[model samples]
Target: MYRAIRIHGYGGPEVLQLETLPTPVPGRGEILIRQEAIGVNYIDIYFRTGLYKVPALPAILGMEGAGIVLAVGADVTDFEPGDRVAYPTSLGGYGECRTIAADRIVPLPPDIPFDVAAGGMQRGLTARMLLREVYAVRPGETILVHAAAGGVGLLMCQWARHLGVRTIGVVSSEEKGELARRNGASDILIGYDNLAARVRKLTDGAMVPVVYDSVGKDTFVASLDCLAPRGLMVSYGNSSGEVAGISVRMLATRGSLYLTRPGLTTYIAQRGALLGGARDVFDLIAQGVLRVHIGQRFALADAGAAQTALETRATTGSTILLP
Candidate 1:
């Protein structure tokens, strides 16, 4: 038996329990992997808090993980036992091992570590899609990245810089601001008190072409106001809380902004899309351009505390669970 963080009744971090279960067998189009690490996002907290409705009780709590394939289904031909892989599965990632659909798994770049690959998948892939598909940033264009020191934020800042785009980062604390700066944010703003004003200043009275926001609620309106004419508001995650309803006219009034709520699953709907998008992340990692910060780590058994820390915003960078 192997221990996994399983929740019988979703409620709070306290409810995440470590329970042992028999090893699972892979089905057609699936592979069983012994997880080396689990990537814990605030979305896990949302699942625990009932914000994101999940299935029946007693479910394992993870969306992404990295490991070595232990077994392959008879129909699976792309991967074999012992291949190092990482994946963003639809569910059940907190286990020591899992049977995941092979297409959801991607081979790791030679130099990337298991923890880093796990750390980078969901967030990094989200950033990749946001930049390449959501609005398609161009060189010399200015963009605003909210929570620019967080997991996805760091990747966006670096990846955008690599594309020769300038970014004005929005962060809560000074420490996070410094982190965003190191990650290639051209400038950083603290708080939403004078957000649009700061962004205007950064761009010399001209706002950015796009605002990538995960810090919803508190920053949504200001993020909208900071956009230049026809800019896009890419509201990817609700780290602050789900964004409230807005008037349709506000989109036109606020620079005719385009609002998009994108998730990794939607962005990679095509099998071809998955491989292409994931390859971008792998290439960035292979070239040493993407530096994922594993700022916090918890043993698989300590998933509860990790969830608590993430929910309270007491942690930064990518937090992971070592199995």
Candidate 2:
């Protein structure tokens, strides 16, 4: 038997329960992974609180993890026992061990630590999708990133900088602002108040061509206002709350802005895309252009506490759970 955090219903962090279950076995095209590290992310919170629907009751809640392959199932050609692998988009990752579709797993380089891979894989892939695929952020262009000290934000900041894009990062506090700056934010704005004005000022009144906002509700309007005409507003998350009650006129009034809510799953649904994006992110890590910080870690049994900390925005960079 192995331990896992399972939730029967949606609510707060208190709903997460640790329990023991029989170790899962691999089926066709699947591999059994002995999880070394689990990633804690806001999406897990979303599923926990019923913001994102759970597929079933008593759900094991997590989407990413790194581990060693203990076994491989029939017809799996690319992996074998003892492979170091990590997945960015699999459910039921908050466990000591679980079976996952082999295609969803990416082999990790020997030099990349399991903890770092767990913390960065999902967020790094997210940053790659947003910057490379969503709107194709280009050199010499200025962009605004919300929650700049957070996991995806940090990666986006650094990767964008590597590509010669200037980033204007918005964070909740001065400390987070400093962290964002250290991660390659050309300018930092603290708080949501007068966000458009601050962004405009930083960009010399021209505003930015793109605004990658994950804060939602509280900052969606400001994010729209921060964009240059016909700019793209990539609203990828809802840390504050979901954006609602908006009409097309809002976009028209705000410089013909284009809005998108892209998911990493959609971007990497194909096996080639999945492997290619992960390779790009890993390559960046190997080059030292992207630095991943695992700012908080908790024992797997303490996932509830980790979720609470994440919900309250108490952690920075990436949070991981050790099994």
Predicted candidate 1 versus true structure: per-residue lDDT over 1-323, tens digit per residue: 78888888869788898898998999989999999989998788888888887787878878999999999997899999989999864589998999899988888766889999889888888888889888899999999998888899999999999999998888889999999999999988888898888888778988888899998888899989999998889898887889988787999988777888888888787778878877888888888899898899999999999888877778778999998
Q: For every candidate structure, what is the RMSD over all alpha carbons to the true structure, in angstroms? A: 1.2, 0.7
- Candidate 2, residues 1-323, lDDT tens digits: the string is 99999999999888999999998889999999999999999999999999998899989999999999999999999999999999998989999999999999999999889999999999999999999999898899998999999999999999999999999888999999999999999998899999888877787899988899999999998889998899999999999999999898988998898989999999999999999998999999999999998899999989999998998999899999999
Q: What lDDT, from 0 to 1, does candidate 2 have?
A: 0.93
Q: Tell me the spans in candidate 1 whose CA falls farther than 4 Å from its real position.
A: none
User: Which residue runs of candidate 2 sit more than 4 Å off their true CA positions?
Assistant: none
Query: Model 2: number of clashes?
Result: 0
lDDT, residue 68, candidate 1 = 96
| Clash pairs (backbone) in predicted model 2 | none
Q: Give the alpha-carbon lDDT of every model.
A: 0.88, 0.93
